[model samples]
Target chain A: MQMEATIAQSVSEKVKTSGAEAVIRSLLAEKVDLLFGYPGGAIMPVYDALFHYQQALKHVLTRHEQGAIHAAQGYARATGKVGVVMATSGPGATNLITGIADAMIDSTPLVCITGQVGSHLLGTDAFQETDIISISMPCTKWNFQVTKAEEIPAALAKAFYIAQSGRPGPVLIDITKDAQFGEVEFEYSPCQNVRSYKPEPPINPEAIEQAAELINSAKRPFVLFGQGVILGQAEEEFKSFIEKTGIPAASTLLGLSALPTDHPLNVGMLGMHGNYGPNKLTNECDVLIAIGMRFDDRVTGDLSRYAVQAKVIHLDIDPSEINKNVKVQVPVLGNCKETLKHLTQAVKRKSHQAWLEQFRAYDQIEHEQVIEPELKPLGPELTMGEVIRQVNELARGEAILVTDVGQHQMVACRYTHFKQTKSNITSGGLGTMGFCLPAALGAKLGTPDREVVAVIGDGGFQMTLQELGTIFQTKAAVKIIILNNSFLGMVRQWQQLFFDKRYSSTEMVNPDFVKIAEGYGIKGRSIKQRSQLKEAVAEMLDHKESYLLEVHVGKEDNVFPMVPTGASVSDVRLS
Target chain B: MCKDFTITVFTEDHIGLLNRITSVFTRRHLNIESLNTSESQIPGIHRFTIVLNTTEEIVQKIVLQLEKQVEVIKAVYHLDEETVFQEITLFKVSVEQAAQHNLVERLIRDKNARILSVEQDFMIIEKTGHKAENDDLLEFLRPFGLIDYVKSGRVSLIKPDEELKNLHELVNEAKQANNNQSFN
Candidate 1:
């Protein structure tokens, strides 16, 4: 790590008087190591001043603003720091939207800056002009349009800070061309008064005590962990609490990587694609303790029917998220780790043999019943469900897996064993179609130390298939497994159930994925035989650059044991 | 089919842009409506409009989605005849229509529509005004009527009063508060 102690000063001395320069300098002051960007007319001033911090900032030039954003997401995920991306006005600003929305949905930390046509041309529809601030309103955690040049430094500084704090998500800074071009004497001072956002920091004593008391009181309590645990780095305390109380625990997609997959107390995922023990227990248990996880609809099918048998104790850093969805019997509004620590001292573990026996028996029966293979044909004859199990077995708890939207995603959620938060990245609320590939890039960027695998369906892979070039350019150590069923698999599956297999436009036939992967300068392979999967995965993971392994599975395959839309957990059908 | 026939209002410094125009279109409840409002250039010019969907539901939904932005001030699919209206449209007619086109060319000549271009198929015409102008013009040019036309919806300005001024101030105040909250 080459230290840039003087680079910050060099930037401050040179660009301090200029608005765009001040913005660039503030970013450097915040110790931003990388930025992804595409430059144009309105944003030229920012790019020009960006020259000074070249030593400190590693700027990745992406072909499109969307690519810039996704790459930034990759950078953020890899470094566990806030990602940064910049773009010029109009289309450039709009292009960054999908990526920003993705981060919002998955709760990733990102800072996006877009240039607006000068303040004078604000709503004129001037060539290349867009109302960037208003357009990005709902998609971002916060957004601004800096009309005055003097606002740039503070705006950039605040954008960076807000993006990194409190249930982190994307923030946007839209500076007019005038702002970027204006000159201003800049004095760098730490931003101290953010009046609008007062995040209740992770430090509530009494709530922690009550949470601990509830945890110790219930022998069958289970922790439904999510991404906040990973964001807060609360896994250690999470592990400690589980060990102390001997409580069974499961995780949401975002919370997958927070704990070790091999940990004995680890139950599994609980949701539409949830596994036997976790899913069953979620609806069966008396004490359901959810930590650092929002009760997303995907995770809790038919909210009215979810955890009906359970008394909920919800712990999260975000107060908005606490009672937004699932009502909490015990609300611990603090960081998971801090809250858990307080509980360890405030409460004692209990020995309830009857409750433990009840959970164990249910787990045993369901595991046996659910894991039995239901067959379909395409060589290896592996259903989407089978792939999740195999991936789980082979991973044996070390790989960081990501998935695209559809049945395969759900099956992976149900069958794959996840142990940590922020480990799994998928479009949860957004349910974005072409999320896996780019997001896998983000995930690999987030955790370069871990083996990153993205499980995508044939349809999802095709949506943003243009990103193969990005993966190759970065040489990201990502192994993408394409579950080629030749259909918009999930939609097709739904039609199969709801519309009498009308199929409509759901069916699709894809080109050779391996060939397509190879076309982009990455290693590629296709596996149709069951025996080929394990070795192919091993070889693909070993590749220096990104690799694509396409597995041709059955098109008729649908994620089974499904509780259709508006259906309760008891309405689950296994066919 | 829930297609919307919109009326865009661009008015002079009026005391009641909304009251007069809206009451006209809405009073009869002639049709369900959708409306939108925003400030346009030529300072103090406010854009007020209505969307009446008697056509495709999807387009209506798409327009409704577009109306969701906060800066849009007001956007809804609740339209009726009692709504006030003003609109500008640019249409293209065939050069062939010049020789013997009926009441259409006559109207085109009256509105002083500039013929943008004329090809083997037809010609391009540009016009601006009230809905009757467009309708009477459309009836006249019905023979060699259109290639394509884009109309800006109604835009109405409120009389500069305590209320509208306060709204502008409130908007700035909200923006300031949001900006302050975000930086922290």
Candidate 2:
């Protein structure tokens, strides 16, 4: 670490007196080595200060503010460090909100610094000004407005600490123009405490003991792992516990990479649109030890009827998550790693051979027979399952998969087997669209050496298509596949199930993706028929720079055998 | 981890404050082993306390939560055992006819306590503040005979730090700047 000498303790040290300089100084003290952002008038102060610190920090200019925030998320998710992004006030700030909420829901540690209109004009409905603090409150771990330049240091430092500390989440610090321009002696030290925030720790000893007792007592013991295990770095410990107890494990989409997909005990995914055996096992298991995974509607249809036969033991890091959705008979709150360690010590091996045999038999039967009648003529020349299988083959057990929200995400969930948790990134809780393009850019940037593929639907890719410019600008080689069916796949599937197939505004008009990619000065290809799928995917694979591979699939298709909402687990509708 | 804490709060439990209060107890890494909340008849007021263990930062965070609660009028957190004040409970005893007369005036003069009820069997006395003070008075009043007593839990407060750099100076500067900008 450079011993920065006699750093400006007060405003006088700035070669330029502005809040922007203080922001730079604060960031420097916080040892912020990199920043992701887009420039604008409202954020000029930040840029001005940033110029002086070029030697100390690196900056990546995203094509849009939204891209910048997702890049930050990618940075955070990959490194488990606090991701930071900067943007101009108004639309710039608003643009970053979805990404901010995305990080919030996923509990990634992200710090977003946005420019704000000056204090005098705050509440007057000033042009290009949004009440970012109020707007981001529910979506942030905490939100603040630094109306004064002097508070900038503390606020930013506090933002980083809170973001990286206990049960990390996104935090926003809105700096007003005056504060950005104003100068003060900048002192950067983390705030030891913030009044309004309190993150719960892992469950206490008694609770852990009771949880272990339940696990030990069950004849058909199984674990439903979620992203929390990844966040807690409990993969090794989790494997250890399961090895000792011989529990069959299934992962939520976010927990895909936690266990190697090929493990015998690994049931690929459970719930609607998942592997039949796993979903059945999930329903029939006597005890469902759900770790870190919330009972998202997609994962657990009909909360009342979800795993009705089983006694669920819920373990999560957040107290609000314990009973907020699915009611669990045993609620254990704590870090997933810590809680798993306690369980490993407290539990003993028990046999569930009869239970295991039943599931295995079902697995063989389901694997041999068609789970659902193979997608017929209208169901597209290629099923999502086939695409994932080919993609995984091309992936060579390496490249991280980034997905946007929709049926494709489900297809990816049931289809791909991950080697580690967090290897699969998606908008889990906040299922935001237009999420993949930028998030892939961020992920590729975070891991430039590794190949990264963004598996996206037509509806989502359009939301952030502007990012092709960012890819061209940065020359980030991220391979993206537009699962183009000319409709919002998930909503269409919903309509097919719930709304009488009255597809309202779900169909998307045609766009020449190749031309769009060309407009951004990148390579693009279009696949119109089944014979073209491999060729398009091959072209994307060998492309030297970012490529947009548009695969035209059928529009009438649905991710079938889906357990419709409000339907019991045992009542899944498989045609 | 084994965490322990001793805290006392002075406040009014406004609607929804109890949840806000306990929410902190649950949210922060504290395991509330025991919690007590009861009426303080000083109009819309109540006293609540929690015992738990956690880091100093978490405890201060809880204090900040208490201060932020809309219903909590005031909050005090004390850690030291000896240097805080607590309410003194009262005890009454049967007095022999001869000892009763002297005891009444003696208790009143020494402890500044008042006798609320008097009967051949016993007199009810009330004393407030330090436990030691109440004990001294109870001894004199016990001439009748020892009865029963209740001492409220120890409520403690560490003296607030003397103001160093004015924390509100920034607010004042912002105010002045606002005024100047408005004038322009």
Candidate 3:
């Protein structure tokens, strides 16, 4: 448990500081303004140190550790900075697992610090002594444990560097109790490189030329992108690339906000429940240029039939992602901003008017069969789409929308409009429920000037409803909209469509959400009639503070344009 | 095809390094048949040898994944024919029976094993070979009042040298950097 004294030896004057103080000082040096965490016995020293540095940092005490991490994720997603989360050992550390996994799959940068028992008591089944490092190893970009005081600054620096660099993900550092209490001479330095680790791999120029040649020569070129654009902050570059080429582009679920929803070349989302044109035309496209997206199973249904006719050009930052799922004719590896800038310089301006019209034709058909009826509901019951449609109009498609996972998540992603980059945050790869409530808190905290809206379903909202206390304390000014369908609507849709109408346990008997919002001292309202929908949404947006609006929607409504399980992306259902 | 393969990983020695390495296997649900670890020829680095029965496709993916770990320097897998591998086994037999029979001496000589020590209660026999050969010796020594047995995980060496002169250079440069006051 001895720490290396080599790094701090050169300092002319070294202040003796405890491990806890070193951690605080390191965070300050990293310019971490806000941290979200919960306190416990093992982590008390750090919290005690946090008390001394209250003026320099802002710490949000979430109701649960999961809330803390998801809030951090929201903050990270909204802003490009790495988010920080802290918790104690055992249950406190374990509670952050879901959010950690969510951040890992979605490539959000987060640094999680968990307390451990004394160094000597790590493996003796001591109270609150769980092996957080081992538990988080698979999900983290890198993880380490510090049992000695002198190692605290070095490990924190490494953790921050690893978490924020390249294809960012979560990194955890578990510090034992002795390290927090022990004092050592401290000198802080940021880690710029690790011998075996290279954050950004070098891009191949020849492959970029190959990709540019493919884009220029093809008549029916299509672009599919994901969060890598936002992660790289290359939204402008992506927009210019597609606009200059005059090619049709579609986004994965997490890539929604990277391009303006109303952009002429930006054709909607690309997934199972995505827009009609994107899903149906994936196999028909000639040259498929995938940027920053891994072609996840949800986006590429029945991989054997997905984009088989197309010559694939894949651009990504991670090397392992390059032929991991779909084979690529040309692979360009590096940060998307740098590579896209290079590709843009090489690509010539061209238009595929005929190919673009085909997408419009498909969109027209989908509009006639699906979007029209949902937006203008003739039935007595309210629908989820109408709620999204109203919200879309009132917000002018500019509000940052944080969505929980389920049928409602699909509905929001489908109908919501984005006018700016980094405006959409949700659990895309992990499909984690209860993500929006706390994430919306983080998002609003990160971008206080921007309006933040959290769209949740009754089933998903109930999972993390305890975060209402956080909202009440922080007054994050997030607009919470709930689409209340009395069932776990997505699973129920599957049961109805595929399982012969056997509902099973998908149905949920719930309490009044508006009443619950009132208990948290937040403004609230619920609408069951169509006449109240527009005004209620407008009022929710007009309110200066946080507000919750619940709308009762059709119980049996299902998300359409779905490529059935094990089916090709082209075989989308309209009902 | 699904068969035995040994994956070797080189990494910097650090606390929880073993747990980090094993967690990769645990995540993929790949069962480790045998594993061995020790310091390599290079200073400040450690080597781990892990044996798993999986398909060639899976093993390739696993190596790419293991290389992604921050501390891991390199990860490569080799088939049985590609490398020379061995596992050591020890057998302890009753001392009284050992004195009465010539079969024990004959079996030990045939297997190329040798007696480590002879004590009052039991005698110990040691053998080093592949798993199959070691198992054969254990079976041969079982009938003569076998007291206890233990076997170590496999150790392996490929045919060609795994020389990375640059890696040694980096180590030396790190030492040089430590002595001076240069920061990047």
Candidate 4:
């Protein structure tokens, strides 16, 4: 019995494993439960290894490489975990470029693994070879190419650490096929530190004190927050800071849902199609405190005229974002969760009742001129705003709303109500057109208990309609609403106003979307009349499985509260 | 507003870091006039010297973006007045022409250039100076049948005390802290 035990122990200690198996083992060690990927020639070995480990790690086969990466992004945004994706070399890796760029600009955390050609075949233009390392360098926070099996574990660990750390972004690791086939003694150790990469900068107490003094003395202090709050898991800290200061808060498009929609201090969204109060009051505020949000061009219409009167206090984890667009009086550099706590303790509480009333007055004007007419239109033609209103009423501010880019996306961001953080997901920075369908599928998988709804446009829905097959196969209960306008609505709106009503290539004759859904073995409904809207959305929400609901709305409807291309934010029009 | 600026980056030696550093400039459509890379006094650390002509505002932004790279320890930019820098240029001339003209030898002596090599067919001259000085020497040598001309990128040192030594100590401390935490 002793000799038998000795033999078994020695055998277990020196067992050899392939790099493909090592990749799976490393993922399991990282506690990665799900992956979005598609099988291909170069990546076949990893897929083969994945088959035996199916019970521990679940793989969702997406229809395309772009779909896989977007789905991974959705998963990351929904769960605040690093999303994982895999694809083959050459065309497969090239297809993921758009999503990588989208993730980079939006600060989504993802680790994408691509299979490369054999090390010997590199630079020889072998069948499926491409230099993905160079192609992905600008977009990725960091990336590495592994030509040996021994390098797999360390590369993956670093990829995950870099991807999900401070100011999170996407990272890529390209593993050669020969490495996947080679053998090694597989052991896993998670990366805890990279000497040159400091994920979090040291908090400066003096900067926080300066910011608080500005907040305490201001007559009208306005707070602008973004996805950084959600990404940092600092929603509670942000709420405490705003509540303590009694400051009015506005959200950028990506920052929506970081603060509850119905919070008393919450004003509305800010951008080209943002609310009347936030855009106009931006110029009126005496002190502007921007937290965990970069000043994107869409939010600041013309940098020269944006908030020139205000003393800006910017809080961000990234130092580069401080003076990139607008100069700030006090720069607080650290995680918002930590910096907000310090600021909350340092500030003095005082209500700006008169300043608050200014925003309320602007809100009243916007409501009468824009909101009331769009949500409860007197005309026979239905508007995109009303569809979102009905969905909001049914979902009760609890569902996860994923939107594609277009007029419908703007309408959804403007109208959707959220009671929770991380509940509103969209392609904010990159404004990717086909992001909604696959992203919703990944979000649903990430949080299976939540009601997931994908709000898409007629134009954007056709961009990745094949994802319906993924929903059909997985039986994920995602509610899809297509506000079909039979035109590329946002562009058509711009063409109408800016291009002398020349429709150009904006008009689209779409396919039978509901029929396509049915062909995928999922139930769906189509509606054109205003009367059927409420009941149809309710049915979609109550369905036990995946359902598609297409609502045909006004073809030339424009997203309003306009800040035309070069106009100042204060000059936003409500017509 | 556009003037010469020198950017120095200290980083760990890692594969593909150079590409990551250069792409930051390419993304902004900024032209890099010269670039030099070498090992620093500190072991295992590398230094990159890049010279560009841009506004102070844009150069500051580029420096911040460079430090954002994972392997980069620190990135700092200095105006020409704040730094002492030089470029080395090598000129190859036909030996026949050099011996035929006393002006070539007189010009080399006047310009503080030294003869690096004297072969039967070709003569090589080396000069270390600023860009304008090198250009002047090239102009003087062109009439003497200059066969080939090559100039190295600008290599620079900040006029102030060495800040990187202090930064290197801090980096080591942080790495030590990381190691201690991992043990727990």
Query: Which candidate ranks first by TM-score, i.e. highest?
Result: 4
lDDT of 4 by residue, B1-184 (tens): 9999999988878788999999999999999999999988677778899999999999989998999998888889988888899999999999888888875558566998988888889988999999999999999889889999999999998876776566667656644545211221
Clashing pairs in 4: none
TM-score of every candidate? 0.73, 0.74, 0.93, 0.97
Give residue A443's error in model 3 in angstroms: 0.5
* Top-lDDT candidate index: 4
* Candidate 4 segments exceeding 4 Å error: A1-15, B162-164, B170-184
Off by over 4 Å in 2: A1-18, A29-31, A191-203, A368-380, B1-184
Between candidates 1 and 3, the one scoring higher on DockQ is 3
Q: Candidate 1 at residue A307, lDDT? A: 83
Candidate 3 global lDDT: 0.88
**Over the stretch A226-281, how does candidate 4's per-residue lDDT look in tens digits?**
99999889999999998888899999998999999999999999989999999999
Could you give the DockQ of candidate 1? 0.05
Q: Using lDDT as the measure, what is the rank order of every candidate, best first?
A: 4, 3, 2, 1
Decoy 4 TM-score against native: 0.97
CAPRI grade, predicted model 3:
acceptable
Report the Cα lDDT for residue A303, model 4.
96
Query: How far is A322's C-alpha from truth in model 1 (Å)?
Result: 3.3
Question: Which of the two candidates, 3 or 4, achieves a greater lDDT against the reference?
Answer: 4
Better of 1 and 2 by DockQ: 1
* Native contacts, share recovered per candidate: 0.07, 0.00, 0.33, 0.53
Note the residue pairs that clash in candidate 3. Answer: none
